[model samples]
Target chain A: MMDLVYTPDQEAFRAEVRAWLAAHVPKVPLASFDTAEGFAAHREWERTLASGNWGMVTWPESYGGRGCDLIQWLIFEEEYYRAGAPARVNQNGVFLLGPTLMEYGSEAQKARFLPAMASGEEIWAQGWSEPNAGSDMAAIRCQAIRDGDDYVINGQKIWSTRAVYADWVFGLFRTDPASERHHGLSKILVPLSAQGVTVRPIPQLNGLPGFAEIFFDDVRVSVDNRLGDEGAGWQIAMATAGFERGLMLRSPARFQQASRRLVSLYRQHHGDLMDPAVEDDVLRCYMDAEAYALSTYQTASRLLQGGSIGPEASCNKIFWSELDLRIHDTAMRILGARAEVEPSGSSDQEDLGTWLDGFLFAQSGPIYAGTNEIQRNIIAERVLGMPRR
Target chain B: MNFTYSAEQIEFRDVLHALLQAEVGAERIRARWDTASGRDAALEAQLRDFGLYSLMFPESLDGLGLSVIDCALLAEVCGRAALPEPAVETMMVASPLLVDVLDRGLGNGSVQAVIEGVMSGDARVAVSHAINPHVNFVEDAHWVIAGVADAIYLLPRDKVEVTPLKSVDPSRRIAKIDFDPEEQYRLAEGEAAAAVLRSTLNRGALSVAAQLVGLSEVLVEQSVRYASDREQFGRAIGVNQAIKHHLADVAVQIEYARPVIARAAYTLSVSPERADIAVSHAKLAAARVGLLAARHGIQVHGAMGYTWECNVHIWSKRIWALVREWGDEGFHKNRLQQWLLQSNALLGPEFTFGRRSLLPDSRVSDPVSADTAA
Candidate 1:
C-alpha cells in the first residue's frame, strides 16, 4: 500500500525512546570521541543507553537489545539525533561488526561478545586495510598462521579507526601462507592488550588520533575466535562492508538532523545571503537529506519484505558522503568566520565548531569506506551492468 | 508501514512500460513537433481503449478508481518514451478534478456526461490551471477545466481561446488560454475553489515530477548502454573512470529521487494537507536529477549525442520544458523556505516523517498497533 507513516506501537516506542533520551542525554555536549577522556565519557553514555536496553534496538533482547524492528531502530535514531545525544564511540563495533556477528558468528560467539559490545564494556576497532591495501582490500598482507588451535598474527594494519583506545580489533588476516589475493584471508578477532601488539596513533588534521596504526607481532588468539569458514573471510568482510556502506553505519537521520540545523543557520543569516546560488545550495541540503531518508525507508521496507541490500549500497554510500560534503560546505558559507572558530559548545544550531570539524572529516567520506571512485566503479560494473574496459 | 509499491501497481507500471515502448515510437512522439497534425488521433484512441483516460474515474462512474500512487509510476514509463499524448495530465489531474467537482454537486448534466465519456474513453480533458498561465493540448481536448480568479468552471475547447505557443520541448503544445466566464458552469468559489485548485496543482506537479524522473532514468540507462557499446582508446568508453563516474552520479540522484517522488504521491493521496512540501521536494529532486542526467547523458554519448541522430535530446528537451511547468525550481524553493523560515517551524529528523512519529503522548487504537502489542 506504500504507507510511509509510522504505526501506533512504533510511535509508542519512539515516545519511550524520546522521553528516555530527554531525561538522560548530557545537557552539555561531550568532547570529541577521538580524545582519551572523550572516548571514556562517550562510553559512559553508551552504558547509560544500555541500561535502558536502547544499545541496539534491532538486536535480540537476550543480547541486550530491545528486540525491535528496523522501523523502531530508525525512530530511535531520529530521536537520538534530535535530542542531541553524544556521538557513539563504538560505531565500528555496534554498527558494522555487531550486525556481521549476528549473521555469521557462532551462538557461543554471540553470547561472549554481544553483551559487552552492547554495554560499551569492550569497544572494538576494524583491523582491515593494511599499509598496502587501502581501496584494494583483497591485497591485504597480514597473516595469521594457525597453530595448535591458536592463530599467531604478524603484520600491520593502518587506518584502524579507534584502535588507539579500543579494547579489541576484528580484521581480515591471511591464514594460508601459500595462497594469494583474497583466497587465504580469514576473519579473526584479537585483544589489543595481547602480547607483541603495538598501537601508534595517527593524528588527523584536527590533531586528534581518530584512527590509529596497529602493528601485530606474534599476537596470539584462539582459533575459536574465527568467524564463518576459514577461506570465506573475503565473503564475510564484504558482507560487513555492505552493512557499513548501505544501511547501518551512516543512517540518514544523522544528515537529516544536520540539514535541519543548517536550515536554522541559513535562516539566521537570510538577510545577508540573498545570493540565489547560496539559497539553492541550502535548499539542496534539505532536499538531499530528505531524499536520502526516503530512499532508506524504501530500502528498509524492502529488507523487511526479505530483500537483501546489494550493490545499491554503492549508490547509498556515494549519496550520503557527497551529501555530507554539501551540508557542511553550505554551513561554512553560512557561518563565514564563525566556521573557523574552536568549539564553543553553545548549542547544536549555532555549533560552528562542529560544522568546521565536520567539513574536514567529510572529505574522508569519498576516500574511506571504499573510495568514491571505487564505489562509482562498483555501481558501473555491478549495479548499472556496464563493461569493464 | 511499508514503502514499496504494491503488486498491482508494479504490474500496471510494467504493462505501461511495455506498451509505450512498442506503440509510442520516437517518430510518433515527434509528430506534434513537426508540421504534421499536432494530435495522434489513432494513438489517442488506442490509449483511451487501454483505459488510460479513466484511471482516476470513481468506481461509481464504472472505472478502476485508482489514485496517483497506482498511475504515477506508469507515468515514469511514459516519460521514458516521452509520451506526447497528455495522458498524464488528462488522467491524473483533470479526471480527479472532474470527480471532485461532481462530488461537490457543482457539475451539471453535461459535466456528468463528460466524466462518463472519459470513463468510456470517449472524452479527454485538458486543465487550464491558473498557476500555468496557459493551456496545454487544447487541440485534442474534449473539454477544459479552468481555474480563474478564485473560481472554477467547465468550458468547451471552442469557447476557450487557445493561442498556440512554441515550446522548448517540441512535443508540448503549450498555448495562452482565454475563455468566457459563465455562471452556469461555475464549479465552486472561495475556499472550495482554492481546495480544488490546490489538489490539482499538487497532482499536476507530481505528474510532472514523475515524468522528469522517468526521463532521468532513460537518459542514464541509455547513456550507460551507449557507453558500454561505444569504444574509445581501444576499449569500451564506459571502461574509463571519467565516463563511469559521471553515469554513476546520475544513477545515484535517480535512486534517491524515486523514493521522494513516491512519498510525494503517497502524501498527496493519503494526507493532502501535508502534501505541499512533499510535492515541492519531489519536483525539486526530480528536476535537479533530471538535468544532471541530461547533461551527463549527452556528455557520455559524445558528438553523436549532440547531433539530431541521437534520441537523447528527446528525453533531455522535455526535461527542460516540464521542469519549468507546474511550478519551477524557484517556486518550490520559495515554498520550502516559507515554511522552514517560520519562527515556530520545527526542522529536524523528528519532523522529517511528519510529527506523527514524535507525538507519543497522543495514542490511537488501530489493528496494526493491536497486532504489535500482542
Candidate 2:
C-alpha cells in the first residue's frame, strides 16, 4: 500500500549487493571507453559482472540473470553505483535491446543473442538516427531490400553510439521502397564486420570516438535477423525507444551516483566557493536525483502490478535528460578552472576534467533518445491529451 | 518497497476527488473573496461532516487515525478546488499537534474541549508557527495554536487581537495575531513543547507542499483547457509547440513533485527521524514547481490571466500565498544545507530514503555519523 519502506528480504538483498560490490568493485576507476584499451578493460569488467550473474539481474535466469524483479534490479543498481563501479560499456545491448528482445524476439533469437549480450561477448550499438532523421526518426531513408532469404541493406547512419568498437548494430530500415514515413519498415540486426559495412569514428567533444557514422553498402543479412514482423519496425522501434527513454536505459542510480559525487565535490570546496546560489544548485541536483529515484520506484511498482509503460515514459525522458545535464553542469561550476584540465590518466588526482567530459556527454542527453523537444510534444499530445497541429 | 498505493488508498483518493469536485465548486470559493471572513462556513461544515477534520486524530478521539499520506491525499484535492477552509492547517497540523500534546499529558481541560470541538465540527483551529509571520484565517478560527519562543500556547481567538493582513490570495484570509503571552493557556513547554512544535512545523510544511502540488496540477489543467479552447492564427494555441512545451514543462514539474510529497508524508507518519529531510525536499520541490506553474499559467492565458474574470489568478494567487506558508524555498534549502554540512550524510543512490547507518562499513567516514546514525 504505497509502501516506501523496503521489506526485510529486500533489505537483505540490498545488503548482499552491497557486500558483493564492496569486494569486487575496482579500487581505481577504469579508463574512458573511447580508447581501445579502455574499451577492452570495460569488456573485462563486464565479464567479471557476468561471472557474478550481475550483468543484467532483471533478465531471465536462462540468459545469465537472477530473474529478479525491477525493485531488486533497482537495489542492485543503487549498490552498483554506490560502490563506484565502472560504467556499463554494453549498456546499448543490455539495457536497450536486451529488454526489447525479451519482449519480441523468437525463442531461437533470444537463445542466440541474449547470452552473448549478457556475457559481454558481443557489444551492440544503436543505429537509429540518420543524417536527415535526427529527431524525425520515421523519415529514415535507409533501405533493406529483400533478396531471397537475405536483405541487402544500404544506408548511412549517423550518431550510432558505440559503433566503432561494437560487434553488432540494431536499427530500422525501410523494407518497402514504395512506402513512406513509418510504414513498411523493418528492424534489422547487422554484424559490424559483415561485408560492405564501414564504420567511421566521429570524435566527440571529449576527443573520443564515443559514437560513429556507419556506412552500409549492400550489407546483406539473413531474413531471420529481423526483429518482430516486417512492416512492424516502427512499432517495435517505438517499444525499444520507450525502454531507452524510460526506466531501463538511464536508471536513477546513475544520476544518484553523479549527485553524490557532486555533493562531495561541493563539500570539498564550500569553504572557498560557498555561495548560497551554488549551494542551492547542489541541493537541487541531490533532490532531483532523489525525486527521480522515487518516481522510478513508483513506475516499477506499477508495472509489476500489471501496468504498462505508456506516454508517461515521455515525461520521464524529459525530466531525466534535463536533470543529467544540470547535475553535470553543477559539478563543472563547482570545479571552476580545474574543469578545463583534462585528466592525464585514470589515476590523475588533480584532473577534475571528468566532470567536464561528463558535462559534454550530458549535452547530448536532451538531443538523443528522441530530443527533449520531441518528448515534450509526446507528453503534451499523448499524456496530457492536448491538440496536435 | 512498494511505491504504489493500495486499492483502498486509490479508492479513497478517487472518492475524495469526486467529493471535492461536487461540493467545492469554484464559484463557492470565488464568493468568499469579497467576504470579511474569507471563508465559506457551509463548505467548512460540509468538509467536517465528511470526516476530513478528524482524519489525523487518534481513533480514541473518534478520528479516522489515518496516516500522513492519507491527509496529504485529501490536501491535494483541497488545493485543486482552491478549498478556502484551512482544512489542511486544521486537520493535518493543529489536530495532530493537539493530539500529541494530550497524549503527552501536557494538555488540560481547555485543550481537550477544543479538541472535542474540532472533532464535532464546532471549532475551527488555525496554527501560527514562528516560520510564518501571520496566522492564516484567524478570523474564522475559534482556537489559535500559536508558537511563541520555545513554548506553545492554546488561546481562544477572542483572547487575542488579530489585525487583518491582506494576502495576495484574496480567499486566504491572514492576520497578524497579538496576545499577552502570560494570559494564554500554556499547552506544553521544554522538550515536550519543542517536540510538538517540530512535528507541527513538519506537518504544516508537508501539507502546504501537497496542496501546492494540487494547485500546480490545477494550473496546468486550466492552462491546457484555455490553450485548447482559445484559438490563435486559425488554430488552438495548444497545437502551437511553444504553448505545448510550456504546458508540458509544467506537467513534468507536477509529475515529479507528486512522489516527493508522498514520500514526505509517508516518512512523517512512519519515520519521524527522517521527516525533516523528507519534508524539506517535498516543500522545496513543490513550491518551486508550483511557482513555475503559476507563472506559466498566466503566460499561457495571455492578458486574460491577469484579470479577475479569467479564474486563473484565483489558483495563481493561492500558489503565491501557499509557497511561503509553512516554509519558503530559502527556509527549506537552508535547513537541508545545515543537515548536509553537520551530518555529512552518505549522499548517494543507496541513501535516498534510507538512513545513514544503511551504508556499508567502508563508507562510514563522516565525523557526525555517530549522532546521525539511524
| lDDT for residue A91 in candidate 1, whole number 0-100 | 86
CAPRI classification of candidate 2: medium
Candidate 1 local lDDT, A1-389, one digit each (tens): 78877788887888898899989999978888899899999999999999998888888999999888777788889989989999889888999889889999999999999999999999999988988999899899899999999999999999999999999999999999888988989899999999989999999888899899999999999999998889899999887777544787888899999988888878888888455577788888888888888888788888888877745587888889999999998888877766788666666544777888889999898887788899999988888989986
Query: Highest DockQ, which number?
Result: 2
Tell how far residue B224 is off in model 1, in angstroms.
1.1
Which residue pairs collide in model 2, if any?
none
In order of listing, the candidates' clash counts read 0, 0
TM-score of chain A of each: 0.97, 0.96
In candidate 2, what are the lDDT values of residues A1-389, reduced to their tens digit?
77666787888889888888888888878888878988999999999999999989988999999999999999999888878799999999998889889889999999999999999999999999999998998899999999999999998999999999999999999999999999999888999999999999999988899999999999999999999999899999887677544888788999988988888888888887554577878888888988999888888888998887644577888888888898888877777777777766655644476787778889988888888899899988887889987
* Tens-digit per-residue lDDT, B128-232, candidate 1: 888887677876677888887699888777887778888777787788888778887777889888878887888889999999988998898899889989987
Model 1, position B286: C-alpha lDDT score: 89
Clashing pairs in 1: none
In candidate 2 chain B, where is summed lDDT lowest over 10 consecutive residues?
A: B365-374
> In candidate 2, what fraction of native interface contacts survive?
0.75
